[model samples]
Target: MCFGYWLETRGHQVTIATHENFASFVRQFDLKFAPIAGNMEEFLQSKQGQRLIAGEKLKKEEGDKLLLQQLESAWSACQGSEVIIYTPLATFGYHIAEKLGVSCFFASVLPLTPQGCLGF
Candidate 1:
């Protein structure tokens, strides 16, 4: 959110695409909000979410389903975008940018592992 605000201050139009749960908070910064599908709060209270929080890897099918959902929603949110700034978790951003022939940047607050860096 701060990054979006900073970009706005620099005269750039910045919109944050995130879960609906964050819409209010994102709007507080006066940033345009493009809501991605999913109820993060409810998810966090589910068994799968609990497993994820416990560091358990998701089953392959479950992971794929989640990825597909994210890809679809994020693609819609990114329409007509000239540049895409995304987090590591949103790996679909790279593919979307490639298809759109636009610049894409990866931003993260966490340290990247050697394997993760290689993947990027």
Candidate 2:
């Protein structure tokens, strides 16, 4: 949001594609927002989702690749945008944008990784 606000203040139009929760938050700031696939909150509440995020579960089949599906949906949602500024969890945006010839950038807002805890 800080980044989007900064860009918006500088006269750049910014659109955020994320979960409905995040989209709603961004909308409160008067910035453009688009909903991405998968209910983040609902998924996070699931045991499988919690295990997957904690790395306690390994992908065994197509059904286990929820992360990939989420990213793919995000990629699809990014179409027509000038650039895609994505969070770490959506790293696939960078690759997808590259393939589509769209600009891509990364921004980390939450320090959810252990490496972030180390002050890196």
Candidate 3:
């Protein structure tokens, strides 16, 4: 969210594609909001979510289905975009950008290195 705000301050048009629950929060920063499927609160209360919180991985088929759903939602939100900026969790953005014939950039709020520090 802060990143989107910073980009907007630089005169770039920023649209934040996230869960529907965050629409109002994104709008608070004056950034365009694109709805992504799923609600965090509801998910957290689900059996699958509880399993994940307990450190158990989903079965392959379950994981694949969830990934497909997220990809579809993300693809829908990204239509007509000239560029895509995504985090590690949203690596599907790269594939979407390729399909759309657009440029893509990777961004992350977390440390990328095993050393727990950014090289730059």
TM-score for each predicted model, relative to the true structure? 0.78, 0.75, 0.74
Residue 28 shift from truth in candidate 2, angstroms:
0.6
lDDT of 2 by residue, 1-120 (tens): 666777888889888888876776888889888777677788877876788779786557733576666777677678787888878767788887898898888978675555523441
Instruction: Mark the regions of model 3 whose C-alpha exceeds 4 Å error after superposition.
Output: 60-66, 110-120
Question: In model 3, how large is the Cα lDDT of residue 105?
Answer: 98
- Given candidate 3, what's the lDDT at residue 71? 83
Clashes of each: 0, 0, 0
Task: Give the clash count for model 1.
Answer: 0
Clashing pairs in 3: none
Q: What is the lDDT of residue 98 in candidate 2?
A: 92
The segments of candidate 1 whose C-alpha lies over 4 angstroms from its true place after superposition are 63-65, 109-120
Q: What tens digits encode model 3's per-residue C-alpha lDDT throughout 1-120?
A: 676677777788888888789889889988999887778667777998899889999898866766777788999999989889988767888999999999999988575556412222
Residue 21 shift from truth in candidate 1, angstroms = 0.4
lDDT (C-alpha, whole model) for all candidates? 0.83, 0.75, 0.82
How well does candidate 1 score on lDDT at residue 50? 93
